[model samples]
Target: MVLDTQIKAQLQQYLTMLEGDLVLKISAGEDKTSRDMVELVTELEKMSPRITVEHVQLERTPSFSVNKVGEDSGVVFAGLPLGHEFTSLVLALLQVSGRAPKVDEAVIKRIQAIQEPLHFETFVSLTCHNCPDVVQALNIMAVLNPNITHTMVEGGTFQDEVKAKDIMAVPTVFLNNENFAGGRMEIEDILQKLGSKSDGTEFANVEPFDVLVVGGGPAGASAAIYTARKGIRTGIVAERFGGQVNDTLSIENIIGTKVTEGPKFVASLEGHVADYDIEVMKSQRVAHISRKELVEVELENGAVLKSKAVILSTGARYRQLGVPGEEAFKNKGVAYCPHCDGPIFKGKNVAVVGGGNSGVEAAIDLAGIVNHVTLLQRGNELKADRVLQERLRSLPNVTVLTNALTQEITGTDKVNGLTYVDRVSGQEHHIELEGVFVQIGLLPNTEFLRGTIDVNAHGEIIVDKHGATSMPGVFAAGDCTDTVYKQIVISMGSGATAALGAFDYLIRHTAPTQELVGV
Candidate 1:
């Protein structure tokens, strides 16, 4: 029989009243409440006795034992048992009943086998909620394996510890006495590190380098070439061969190249750097960076590297719309890269926010494919080049709305429409569309270098004419740095300059003096 809505509502109310810091006890074969149950029932009986309370029947089985008190003694209730509140409930229940949930046998065995307690402390802040997932995963591991004692320390509370660990961002997990995971981490990755069974079969010794380039973008690749050609032992560390340029649709101005797609041009640049004897470590992230006599870098997988100088070439990410429903409908209907998701919305209406070069280019590109393009601008005019502005104005399918702001994205499951406010008229209107592309600009990924170097108010790393920052033995190049002209050609030129500056610093500091014996 189906339960009536009124009865369900009443049952839910009864369950809500039952939840509190109280111990519940149960006994068998009695219609009336037992003494322990009566105490709990008496407390909650005033709230709602009609909710139903009865003695549970014990099963007659050989496996069951009387020594285990809670054969049928515990409170069963509704509502999702989750979050911090649920953890408190579980602890409370265990205190009264003297029984905990059964853990995995293999995991328990592994915990018992561990000789030492693995102390893991992860620093996190409410501003960085993304860290909680990592913390929760580690907590689960701690539960399964008692050998691991994990603690989540709020970064703001421990200001001294944060300064000591150089905690720039959240999700920084420290394993044992070493900094383990920095950013987002996978479960298997942490597990492998804890359970490494290697016999040094995949190990290799690397020599110390004069300078190490940490990215292979236009700036980083160029830095490696210039440093290597100058007779310095240079190395390049890149998660990808070409960095963000590989995702660009087209590149028009790279000095020699008039018109080239991002991937092909980046491939050529990679080849140019690969011709030298410099070591290239692709698909790797620098997990830890420390300075002693020589700067030391630790890879994500525990490989150690030493260098005299280091260059940060990590670029930036596309700025998000930050409007409601933008993140909810991210891949389904909302997108940042027009070239990546534009084709899917062909013959469909789409809205492009931001009137900059990327936004104007996206509008021009979408006008050809989409049924109609609404170009919304927060200001009176577009901020792109004159040529691009002229091209956008000439498109018949593109409608440029000046002094317009996207107030909110209206969609239940995916993107269906958008609400925009007219800045000039103070009128709000909803546009029925299938997709929205946000190209507001870019945000520097210099979060990793927060206290390491000087950054401008806009969060871009501050550098001099030669791409040298205020920090000694450290340099920054590409979009990460505060260069007014953010073009491919300019990045390459700055990268070359930074490389030369690094070379000079290395020679002056490390090279030995010559007595001029020939003279």
Candidate 2:
């Protein structure tokens, strides 16, 4: 059964409180996933008396159906509910049980205002941690509004449909059969795109700011707080507030605390930044930037903003494996975030790509939970610290493969094996495993600024110790810059330094604002 004792206990607690008879009618076929689905629901039935799962044998192969006891709910899952979409399945069950997902009243109202019926078929894999946020948001919207229907289509189970749609990524949303969004979108982004208020503004109508922080992560938040405290008209425009921090699962390195999760930490960050009078603009990505009198920042949504000084904190994202089956089995067995997805592969064999510190650390972490780990390194030796390698060597279940190049991720519905080539032997080998953790490296999000500002060879923005960029009025911070460390505390420190640097530049270069001369 996929549901472990811990998850079963958790489901028991939730389903025990279930108000109504939550009947899950599951139809499975001849495929292996179909059998897996049957096993999963059979285990769920044993969790709580309120949860009654019925197994309907399907004549066809690989196709399945799951729905509540009602006819008009218009909510269902056509595949197995595992991985990150597991969140969607659980939340949807809770919603059907008369419990609502946590959402703001303002957002609920905005969702209710949608005039036309919108069906959001969000294609997702079970391992995608970011997919849950969008799926949960849309599910809550469906619960709030009768005009909306949201379905989580597990990409692995439904390959024919995924191929038909030409979907290359998880979290790709099809709004009413049209391509709506591409990647991780905030709740605000979903609302605005569907039918909420306009997210764009004319450059002339927009108010000027003394400083504008382009990102809303720890760095951007810290920068905006520091700049606004100086009594200057400071603003921030971010694609999302938390940025890469939200993707992080466990955070123990922040000096003050022993441990904290990503979501709660980001919520605290938003609350902390709310105390100041900062013009926070969430759910906006910068399209381009140019210096015309002031730094002109144009958004993908067609809005243009002007600021005297700017701090770049766009942050970095995890690099992909670019191998076959890597995209298709992303959440199934091929994963990127070990912290976020390591637990999903408990008691299962897995492999890790790269020999860096992150890869070795991930192997060490996963070894405690999973049955075994096979680490593949392209280099002759481990790039991680000697201590880390020693610790990894201490683990009996962990195996290290040096000078290996990952060739393909092999699996049908769920990832069960990986093929890699030995660089020295010039021979290919296959390892049977459930998961692949890719920890090669990170690429900064600074390609938009080709040469507007100086950047390192790795595309990271070049900034001084004070967080000042090569340009006079511009500064940079966080993972997007050439900072040695890419942690939260370091990014926050750099952000504050950038704000202070921008403030100093403004004081020396720009004229002071005229005070009111009225009686």
Candidate 3:
């Protein structure tokens, strides 16, 4: 059997939910991957009475398509969908067998409304935690709309195709044989990219909020919940619902929970928020914020929102290398998330930049997958924990260089090498590599409030102990503020403090509004 006994048992339980008969139309060759694919499919067929296998020709060999008994579903997998993609494969089988996908009805309508034929292929690694979201979203679209077709192209099994397409990132999507997008994206994000209207009409005439949280990460979610508990009008606007937490892999620092992943934690947060009456506007960005009769917040979609108080919890994003070719080579040969993109560089030389915990951890992880890892640190010594540093040093394929400053990421179509300077010797050196993973740090997402708010040189909002900013009635919290420590629990605590601070400001400063006075 291609699957372990434990995995096969769990898969058997999920397969029992199949609503109708389905067939696995497989195209195979006399290769190892093909043999593995055949074994996996036949094993699955034996587990479910409703499933059967059919040998057939497909666009890609060592691939298979899950279809209803009579019609094609247009959802294909180009390799073994185990690891992080195993859930995606199971969902595909269930949905293709006439089971409804658990998505919003409005989103289903939008997917079905697309008239243009779109053939999407997403390249992914089995270890990528972020790739399944994009793959599942596109698969849902394929299952919902006959005009849309999607294929999960496993990069490890089809390295030649990945090289031909010059793909260095997981979940890199191509539409109609051309690059469409890269990185993790939800179904709504994909719809927006396809010109689906996300106009602000739905929010234009909405009632003003008592408190408006400007982000939807851990901080924003906490604040919104706190404010809504007070029976006041609460709203949250975010570029994406989960913010930086969505890209996180494993998080072990959360209190009460021994360990949890980022996406899983965000799901529970969303569920908790759903229990309240907060108005959530996701996939939207705040373009400007100003104080008038009320704090007027303008969204990039041309919608204006007014609130008695505003809490800034926009969170932070990955800091770029800022060196030459870094921006141009993004998704080409430069990447940020080692967990998401590491397997794509299997058996190739790569470099990890930075000396902190994230950098050292990335170097240690990549050393197991990539052929070699070169870790560059600008400081005289690594800033990681002694245990982590010892572990990273133990890796035979890892090379550590202290006092090294990156100069450029040299590449033509893809990353060919990187140039760095040895600060102690004032000497420059270049190394040929296939990829560069940057783990420097993060920059606060406070550009939109730069001129209006009191921000430090690093663009972090200045906040007091109560999370109150320089501007009265404006509160800031979480990593976007000048918080000494940036942790999920700390962000949640600050969020509560900010919400209570906003309520206090509303009671003292603003005249007694009906919502506040409970009149």
Candidate 4:
């Protein structure tokens, strides 16, 4: 059987939701991948009476298309859609079988309104937790709009294409055969990239909020929920809902839950937030914030929102090495998110830079996929926990270098090697490798607040015990603040503290009604 008992049982339950019959057109060859594809499709056909299969010639061998009865959905899977992509395949089957996708009505309208014919091909790895979002998003677009087509190309099953395209990252998307975007993107993100207008006027005319949270991560979600529970007008504007949490793979530190993945946890957060009467503005970036009669927060799309109080829970992002060729080689050979990009470098030599817990964990993870993992640390020793360090040391193919400072990431079209200097010996060294995974640390996403609020030397917003920042009516939390620990639980607690603090401020100091200030 292509699927295990548990998976097959689950599939059987979900297959019952299909509203109508669907067809799976298979294009196969006498290869292992093709044979697997045939077996999987045959098994799927047997599981549901609504599913039927037909052998046909397609553009790519060992591929299949999910289509409606007597109609084409333009959604194709170029490889075995197992692992993290299994959910994508299930969603495709249901959607193609006439079940409506759970998307915003406005987003569905935007997808159907596209005038241009766009063919989107997303390269993905089955093991990558982040690839399914992009794959499922494009598949939904294809299923909704006849003018759009999308194919999920598994990189492992198409090595030649991956090499030719120089795709060193998972979830790399191409629009019309041109490199479009990399990393995890939501449906709204894709629409915005296609030049969808946000209509800032809608935001400008909205009533002023009692509390506005400027992020959507764990911290921001906590703040929004805490404030909304108080029966106040709470609105959250986030560039993306999950923020750095989406890139995270396994989150075991969350209280009450033994373990959970990033996407799953984010889904719970979204569901919880949906139960409250909070306004959520997704895919919106805060450009500036100023305090007048009321604090005015300006969005990048020229939308200005006023609030009686603001909570800056904007979290931090992965810190770059700031070395030469890092930017140019990004998505080529240099990458972050080891869980997302590790499988792409299978059997290839790669290096992980950093010595802390994140770096050591990355090296340990990469050692299993890559041929070799050379961990370069700037400090004299690995700073990871004892268990992690011991696990990393047990990896035979992994090498640990202490007191090593990365100098540059060298590459032409793609990364070939990297240079580093031995901090103690003052000697430079180079390692030949195909890819580099950076897990140094994170920098706060508080650049938009510089000079307006009090930030420390590291650009972290300084907050008091109550999570109130130097600027009155403004609070900071999570990794963006000068918090000693950057744990998720800590961030959530700080978020609550900030929300309560903002509520106290709102009650004690009532703001005078005034005109909204323009950015």
Candidate 5:
């Protein structure tokens, strides 16, 4: 029953690509965890002859090992492999069969360059959809490097380890017995944390830039393209290129485009940025920024770089409800991303905060997976488009509450309920649920400025129509700024404006060459 007809068909197709036989040793038990795993692999065995499924009872050993060829090369799944973790199970099966790994070349090169061994242990549960992202990132890293050994343990069955570690969340990763990360993390972040430096030497002593952009989202991409077109020295320092855009599911309000996914739009942004001369420092974070005659930026890796003018387009992050248990239960039934963690809540009740398009869309999406969805909005009515509202109402499993303010996310270790107050009715209500998804709004990513630039009360950088900051020769744009509408196209337009403003300032004060002819 774990593997539906469609999933069984897909597994049959995938298993045929296996180069070697895979043994799945599942524990014989009536427990849900053990039975769920058994049902999954038994279905696979019926479809693919290459997959060997065995049933055994192991009181001391793990519940199951998917490449049961031994501890030398195997992954353990102590719980059912449902949700998005199903993909991880499939990939691990393919990998154990000597399949080529799908990892970034740069990452593989770093892993290949490692002198010391890296041991990674990731704890996960069957219901944690985001666990696969971390597990796969480390799994592929281990696959690329022989010295790297990785293990994925299902927290549900390993109750002793979970209790001993005081683990209340999923996707808890540890490197060398030290905490690495607990939730969704990028491979680059993992590499940097492991002290595996990028391919290039440190950025210290590097040549200064005429204009430096601090983020690599759409706003930063646009600013870089505009600055590069002006034939000026431009560079961008970013932890990631796509930013929050990568976490999005649908992007429909991009002006010319009717619709596109986050990854596609991000790829297009990268492709467009590649058309110009820009110094892109990926996986680098701006630790500090100071402005004297020149704007000096310090990176977390102790690298320093100077710029004549800087654009503050760092963008924003999803705002938390700031209620009790919101932080305590993060990744422990409290999730922000529906696309990344929705499947984990299948057949379980959950709630969504906000009446905006994102929140409503998330509710509608979750209604298809979870048993039920309760959407809370602080406003009198939904702020989403009429079509989105209509589609949301069309779903039977969704309940919308207007003018409801979330009071707290409640649970002992994981979220089990959500409390909210109705502003109009002056009454409080609580919904029993396993997960709460907050899509209320965004908080600008201008904290790194540390009061160096003028920011609004909401911590957003104040920018004029042309993206000029309070400081001369400096500019700001995108979600980091005080823009009325934080759309992708608007951010791009603001970035171009900031670049033009910078160009105008450079020509008038810094003295420009023929590059200033257009202005």
Candidate 6:
């Protein structure tokens, strides 16, 4: 069911009066005669006097209204709550249960004051691990402000839109008509532009910088370091200090550094950038960015920044299992990175889902450390590279289960087993395992960039050889761009390229009177 502002506020108030555990059930069925739905609600009511249940009918309700189905029911179902929409269901329940997720208060205030309805459409695929966080962040915004509707469209289902919009990745968030593109967003950043109370604020007196980078990932960091060293007044804004690299476990391929951990490498990079004169704003969320005489950036803290050039180094995220028990067992038995947690599952059986290179790699890695490895694939053929497929096939400890789709993860406190359906023979089976690593592949973090930059069919940013986007004064690099290879070293190299390009743009435009011809 679509929740409006009034109903959301009312539910929040209702939750504040109650105490104890709460459960909210959103049913897709319209008929009140469904026994399962009734039983579910009955169970919830029995849990605690504070318990509340909600049902949403897909067939017989308005597009965006909260309807009560039964006595004490919180909301009614109105549409399919799958993909990114499932986040909305969680938020609705959280609000009804009186536990608002921790969010920046200023961000919430800004979002609530919006006079226009803000639509955020994010395109994602089931295989992209990194896409979920972007979708979840938008869903949180929708929960706080009913005027904001967040739509999560599967990349395959919206092929036409993908082609038209030139999307090249998943988890791409589109705001109104502008594009925010990939990476996790800090709540404050979202509120600054959408919730702005100032109506007559003019851009007449705002000073501009030579370069402005939107992300603090490897690419953004590299760009900032290079540009700032070149004496450019570079300003780098990021939701967090490190981008996707912060979540990585190890880094073995970074040139110069023989072997390094993810956190350590990021720390070093941050240190290097700190040594320069660059204006680095950590934990700042960029709400809106526009290019006129200079690129304008509105921050969530109610501050505005201007720059002559912009670089988007926002990276991607990990994919998640939508099956039951997956979320419940996060960090318990379900993990996304093998390198991050493989040691914890030593001598224990583990299952690796997906047949791509990452899945095979994870399975092979786990096979070396774990007792056994179950490599489950939804398709009959292995989609990994030839070398990885060969290595995985050579491993006797790795059991390859082709044409298998994971239906559910079963466990009490941790993952004990997983149920899978065979697509070819229609047979269902369960395998016991201590951990399940989902290595489906990476999704480009580009949801916040809809209608703003030119992305590829895969939702990757479309950049020229010099890392420039379709929009002038804006550039992109690293994994976020539509580059053929996505490696840490390559992303760093691209960052350097983008920084140089941005530097050139600033020199040409900012110093138009100077005959700056040579390198």
CA lDDT scores, all candidates in order: 0.65, 0.79, 0.91, 0.92, 0.79, 0.69
Comparing 1 with 2 on lDDT, the higher-scoring candidate is: 2
Q: How many backbone clashes does candidate 3 have?
A: 0
Model 4 agreement with the true structure over 1-519: per-residue lDDT tens digits: 678999999999999999999999999999999999999999899999989999999888889999988998999999999999999999999998888998877788889999899999999998888899999999999989999999999998999999999899989999999999999998989999899867675676689998999999999999999988887889999988878988888999998999999988888998999999899988888899999989999998898999999999999999999999899999999999999999899999999999899999999889988899999999898889999999999999999999999999999999999999999889999999999999999999999998899999999999999999887899988999999999999999999999999888987897423322220
Model 4, residue 209: displacement in angstroms?
1.8
Query: RMSD for each model, in Å, please?
Result: 19.3, 7.6, 2.7, 3.6, 6.3, 15.4
Which rank order by TM-score, best down to worst? 4, 3, 5, 2, 1, 6
Relative to the true structure, candidate 2 reaches a TM of: 0.71
Lowest summed-lDDT stretch of 10 residues in model 5? 68-77
Provide the global lDDT of candidate 2 against the true structure.
0.79
Q: In every candidate, how many clashes are there? A: 0, 3, 0, 0, 0, 40
Query: For residues 1-519, could you state the per-residue lDDT of candidate 5 as single tens digits?
Result: 777788878888888888777777777576766667666777778777777877766432435665635433535555665665788778878887778775556677887888787778888865554567678777777666667767777765667787677554567887788767776666787887777766344565578888898899999999999988888888988887888887776788888899987756887998898788887877787878887777788887677788888887898999989999999888788888887667667688999998998999899889998899999999999999899999999999899999999999999867889999999989999889999999988998778776677898999888887788888778988999988988888888998999888877787777543354345
Candidate 1: tens digits of C-alpha lDDT, residues 1-519: 122455446534644533323323223222222232344334333444322333433221001111113232222211111222233233323332343333334333544455666777766653332444455555545544445656555454455676676543455778776877665443434555667322222224777778888888998988898887776678988766676676576887777768987756776997898799788776566666666788777776677777888887877778887888887777556777676556556688999999999999999998988999999999988898899999999999999988998989877766899898999899998999988999898887677566667899989989887678876777879988899977778778878888887776776677512221111
Off by over 4 Å in 3: 2-21, 30-32, 42-52, 97-109, 507-519
Model 2 steric clash total = 3
Question: What lDDT score goes with residue 341 in model 1?
Answer: 56
lDDT of 3: 0.91
Q: After superposition, how far is residue 117 of candidate 4 from its true place, in Å?
A: 1.4
Candidate 3 lDDT, tens digit per residue, 190-223? 9999999667777767888889999999999999
The top-ranked prediction according to TM-score is: 4
